[model samples]
Target: MVWGRTEEGEQVPKEARVVFQPGAVWPEADVHADSCELVIVIDGTLEDENGTYPRGTRISAQRGTSHHPRSSGGCTLRVLYPDVVEVQRPAPPVAEGGA
Candidate 1:
């Protein structure tokens, strides 16, 4: 459960999202952007080259930082985003003169 939810119990803007995908791991995969983000294991286990994160573990990742999140033995987590980012621009730009 996210304590960062709004009064309506909906996700607030810039709210951190905790992904609780059991038995899911992406080796050497860093996903995210230039925003405040953190990955914490509310229940289960997770680890990367940096260190091993067990249950009740919290990790802090600043802006512009990236890490490969890997979970062993499956887990659930609480991700906190101090700031939310609006993905405003696409990676590739549209044709210059197209309306």
Candidate 2:
């Protein structure tokens, strides 16, 4: 849920609680172009290209960074999007064992 607003009168979401089911993958690619994102794994585990984040782990993604997050065994996350975010379609999955 949105918890804050910007000075320019925009409804900026300051924080969000996200629940991921088992083997769930986020559909969009989040590009933190305007602000950084702070992610806290509240329960279970969250994973991205960087690494696996377990419960109680806090990750600070700086501005201009990007990530496609997913959970292998379900998880709850407390995400803080400090400002605007650029959402892009997720990259096509790579084929296994080469063409």
Candidate 3:
């Protein structure tokens, strides 16, 4: 679901306050070729490819990248998306499993 809308009443490229219950995970990853995203863990733990991010941790997903966010013990997150799309594609494979 789209989060808060702008003063102009648009949901695209919006800011969101999301809550993940214990063991909850976001099924679809976010993908945008021209937009980056910012994720801030407000409480509990959030895990992703980079590793587990504890409360107060901040993460940024670069443009053309994607990630599935999961929380083992619940979490609150503040996120900024340039544009939240209906479809999310997996991130491109790495080179030789590195980077």
Top-TM-score candidate index = 2
For model 3, the superposed segments whose C-alpha errors exceed 4 Å read: 1-13, 82-99
List pairs with backbone clashes in candidate 3.
13-82
RMSD of each: 12.1, 15.6, 16.3
Q: What's the TM-score of every candidate structure?
A: 0.59, 0.73, 0.66
Please identify which of the two predictions, 1 or 3, would achieve the higher lDDT against the true structure.
Answer: 3
Task: Candidate 2: give the clashing pairs.
Answer: none
Query: Global CA lDDT of candidate 2, please?
Result: 0.84
Query: Per-residue alpha-carbon lDDT of model 2 for 27-87, expressed as tens digits?
Result: 9997776568899999999999999999999999998889999999999999887775333
Scored against the true structure, residue 12 in model 2 reaches a CA lDDT of: 58
Task: Report residue 27 deviation for candidate 3 (angstroms).
Answer: 1.3
How many steric clashes does model 3 contain? 1
Candidate 1 Cα deviation (angstroms), residue 40? 2.3
TM-score of 2: 0.73
Off by over 4 Å in 2: 6-9, 83-99
lDDT of 1 at 7: 34
